[model samples]
Target: MSADESSQATALITGGGTGIGAATARRLAADGFHVVIAGRRRERLDATATAINVDFPGAASVIVMDVTSDASVREAVAGISRCDVLVNNAGGALGVSRVEDGDLAEWQRMYDANVLGTVRVTQVVLPLLRRSPRATIVNISSVAGESVYEGGGGYTAAKHGTSVISETLRLELNGEHVRVVDVRPGLVHTEEFSLTRLHGDQAAADKVYEGVDRPLVASDVAECVGFVVGLPQHVNIDTLVVKPVAQAAVHKLYRAPIDWKTEA
Candidate 1:
């Protein structure tokens, strides 16, 4: 799309303060979209918006929002005149625990954020999206949704919900000129996500990447999102699964051999 076309588009991204959300905001802004970054952290949101404005100049805004709250979602959506694109990226794992020994509170939190949060934001934004000439909705799911892993009970289930919602919306919005796409990513390195899953244990977060040659970064996923959103309005990418070269699948990965690099 040309700069003139991009300037006419408006995109709203949830959880835009950090990680994949922030990366998507930056990518979209670079694409010439008027981007709005929404999240609960006011300071982080301001920082992200400021960085975008300084770098991209008049391409971004920040909205303080909590996706889990209906009022917050409604207010945030209401503030925008028209939403050309909606990115549901404000969800994450609460904790890593077996189902039997899991904390019910943690499970509930995951459901509220991962499932209901997406629902709330989508609900508020649909009307505005419908008004756009070429509208698109992208939901950030995970590989965990397609395959279960140990200690991923709550998070996997929540992501599965997101995947289902995306599929159903695609069917419902078939002829509405609004495309719904789902992007499921494998292991990604992000501070807030790993920190929350490990219950604020920084060491646990660090250990997740230990011994791996390299894992997928937030910007990688953001690039995938941008690819989907940048396609022709008539072209819709239903679903996309992205992973690092080291990650083959949810249950399988090719870790580096200890002595191979040294020998080479």
Candidate 2:
């Protein structure tokens, strides 16, 4: 890609290997922005970029980055020269335990990934964003940030911190060129989110959405992000909450009986 082509517009998405991050990369590329997909998984990032490039040639690339590591993030971001949009999507829940029974190490890891990760990546990219004529920052938060439930203390706390970052950054950059958008999604059933949260316990992860018809998928959230970023610069969606109809709130899930024949 040449400098003139890159000047078309650029978007850098963290956690871009899988789930919402990957989906958002595709959406942004389709919207005519050069998309930089970053994550720790090199193969996954490459695959995502490949798919995006097939549809929107020369519009996608990959950068292997671990948002949790300060050095790794700085090094990965150093190569990027421009950013019209920054999607802070590299975050996850670590465990499922109450506050008293929580593992201290897991709690710390959650905070590191979900909160500090956003801060680290956002800080490095803000300068690039400012250089764009119309810049926007999309922070992928969770409904957990807005409300809590049993055994959700640690993840909830970290998401709350993410919410705080979006709110505070918007205020601090009030007259600045960038727009801060916070997207809170509920009951999003990404391929790896629940499994990772349950420490690779498949059965436990399955139970998280068992009997639910259809939870929000990665593309669904990506659509929201794409829509928000494509809006006119003067239009800012400060906070948007998206949830499956089966989920009225964090604790309120309408479950249906599973059909064994259908599964078979």
Candidate 3:
């Protein structure tokens, strides 16, 4: 909750106005990094920045940028003097339709946000990261990238592309001072993720966790990112998959109620 006098690392987190992005900003700020949270919404971004700065003092800032645009990302990074870490987390799913009934525009939007947006931000920020004493790039992917389901075609494909980006970057940046990490989380119950995916359908969003208990929260994934970035430069976490106990796999979720009374 307090700032560390010696913590000078600067981290730029995209989609940082809310959800996992906002949580990671707080986590990194608490870890003593000067956190810049970038997103498209000014209101949400300002709110998050204000909250973080309250806890960590002036450790938090906001950059209003659309990751999907080169000019926006360029402008956003222009003011960033140094960047020791980059967290690519600005992406979402649009709808739950099957492949046959998929919306082309929605699919393209997903691809642009999840895949190319990461590419743009990384490309522009590579120089800043390269200049750092030690740098880390954390890509926020999903277990859906590794598994398939009925209504997850577009999102799965996009996230798989994100996975490839993380993998290829790690290989390309080999022997460099930078560390590339891929964090894939499963069944996270954020306030807006499911709602956005369902296109503001409250009922549909609620059903996502209807019978589930203790689904992964945004802070859980944020903690993983914090831990990964906090490691020594010699350590590179290639890929990490985190899921709740209720979720055994992408296709298998334990929905039954817990029976606390039992014999050992």
Candidate 4:
């Protein structure tokens, strides 16, 4: 095969139906990649694929996939002939609960989604990635992975596991010419994520952003992925931490000072 044909990169992104996943799919397709978007929602996946196809023309496909299910991940990866890029982006918090008051079930759910889900998808797609001359894996980690916050113990622990996995995978794949990249973003405003954590409490979800002027949007993170993926084959960005200007850290945010004259 010619270099162009052989190097024609294809990207398979998990949770690509919405949020950062959808944004990444659109960005990747626009960057001339043949994109395959996978997620649990067939309707949303179809919509994302259609939108990308319309915008980029012959650059998008959709697959119904549940990352937490091994069988589902196996089937999805088996169907793909090649994958130059695999973005493990399907993960979120369950609820904000203190360790003492945390529900074991909720913690388990977070672990399954954030840790096992990533492993299942990566395990199935590694072979296809290895087949390519230039392959890259981008794991969507979080700032919480690096630090703990009040009422974030369960979710933070899971993300910490994800961070460790990404690091270990990089070492394991060192000789295989497969690049591993981890992007950790802080305070991204995504509907499904907050909604899930709050258990469909719209008011609770809304409160998450009430005072924030601008938080990191899905597109912001997506652009970072695009930049990493577009780098030369020899260049590998191991880890990138992105956050909004207002966010200093997990517990630090620039809030408006309390004042009587401040508009409510």
Candidate 5:
């Protein structure tokens, strides 16, 4: 992979204040792409941009954006002229409740951020993407998007919409230079994802990954995004399902200590 150190290539990441988004911004910036990170928090965005600019000066920019709002997305995106890569990583789960007892409002927020938010941003950026010689849109979906579980009612539905959108858009954009990538990650250990979902219950969030060995980190997913975008525009990785060795599937997880020795 080569670096466009001239800052001609632009990659925009939503929910980029922290976690996977921030890591992706750093990786992309290191690869010589001008990175624009968008999120609702000004402070977090600034921190990420500052960190990136340390190594790649003048390669990081931040835009305050709320994906759920139309005006916010439009106004934020209007500042940039070209976008070669867009990473939709702005959404998160609210509650882990069964369908029978799920909170309707929580579901709404999930849909707005995970599903509709992608639509709103894509609608506005379609023209800009079309103009790019080699463009790719990466949606940070989840394992929940592929299959359902007992307590994943709202999140799963929303992510399923995200997964399908990636599928539909790929077909819709046939013959175009743009590539739609759906990155579904499983058992990623992140700072805010579970805390925000559990309403700031630190202990509960900690226990969610307790006993699991080497769960995927935000940077691990960032590495995936970096590799995908670095590939030739003609090569497309349609759907990538990422999980640690501890996780073989949604229902299957090894909680015991995993042996690291590789048999020769």
Candidate 6:
């Protein structure tokens, strides 16, 4: 919730504790934005902020926010004096239960976290964002938002809601100066993402990236965000879909061991 004395533009990232969120915080800080790293875990938020400050020196702040809560989002954004960029990076998948066997509670958790969470944060922060000459809102969605598989019904449905909202908001704010970007990433190999989705099954999580030649990392998506936000306000990238070379589509993936060290 802090900004620099220089009145630097502020970039607020929800779920900034780890993964692509943490990486985005660092990339934006290096690019000269006072980054507010917000998440539910104080330790993770502090760590991301500390890492940013190490190289950029007071370029980061931490806000403990649970995006699923209205009160939390309100209190968290209320403390910020200014917000030039908002990254809706919170929310995660809880399980992969098939449609017929889906747990109602798990479905609700996925929906609340991925869809409603984005809505809550954006609603409170719009006023501050309007103050900036060139404000930007980036929603970190997933390729699942665009497609559906057997066991991915709940997560995909929630992400589709996210995708729809981003599109709807962009249209609603047509004349407004704010830029809305929907970033969709596929097959990213992160420490906690698959593990959490598989309900702490480390073995299953590890299998998610097995034999894939360098599935996209957090930094890869972070770099995409950096580029999108850095662009001139006049040029708006409506939607960006990013995935590893091994993944041609959500259903298509080359999972064999790939050796790129030698000649083809």
Best prediction by TM-score: 6
Residue 185 local lDDT, model 6: 97
The sequence of per-residue lDDT tens digits that candidate 5 reaches over residues 219-253 is 99999999999999999999999999999999999
Residue-level lDDT of model 1, residues 114-185, one tens digit each, is: 899999999889998998876999999999868899899999999999999999999988888999999999
Q: How many pairs of residues collide in model 6?
A: 0
Off by over 4 Å in 6: 1-6, 259-264
In order of listing, the candidates' clash counts read 0, 0, 0, 0, 0, 0
Model 5 Cα displacement at 241 (Å)? 0.5
Error of 6 at 257 (Å): 3.4
lDDT of 4 by residue, 46-116 (tens): 99989998888768887788988989998887777779999999988898989999999999988998899
- Which of 5 and 6 is the better model by lDDT? 5
Off by over 4 Å in 2: 1-5, 257-264
Q: Local error of candidate 2 at 13, Å?
A: 0.5
Model 2 lowest lDDT segment of ten? 255-264
> Each model's TM-score, in the order given?
0.93, 0.95, 0.95, 0.93, 0.96, 0.97
Query: lDDT (0-100) at residue 256 of candidate 3?
Result: 76
State each model's C-alpha RMSD to the native: 3.4, 3.5, 2.9, 4.2, 2.7, 1.6
Candidate 6: how large is its RMSD? Answer: 1.6
Q: Which stretches of candidate 4 lie above 4 Å from their native place?
A: 1-7, 257-264
User: Candidate 3, residues 50-128: lDDT per residue as tens digits?
Assistant: 9998888898888899988989999998978788999999999999899999998999999999999999999999998
Span of 10 residues, lowest total lDDT, candidate 6: 1-10
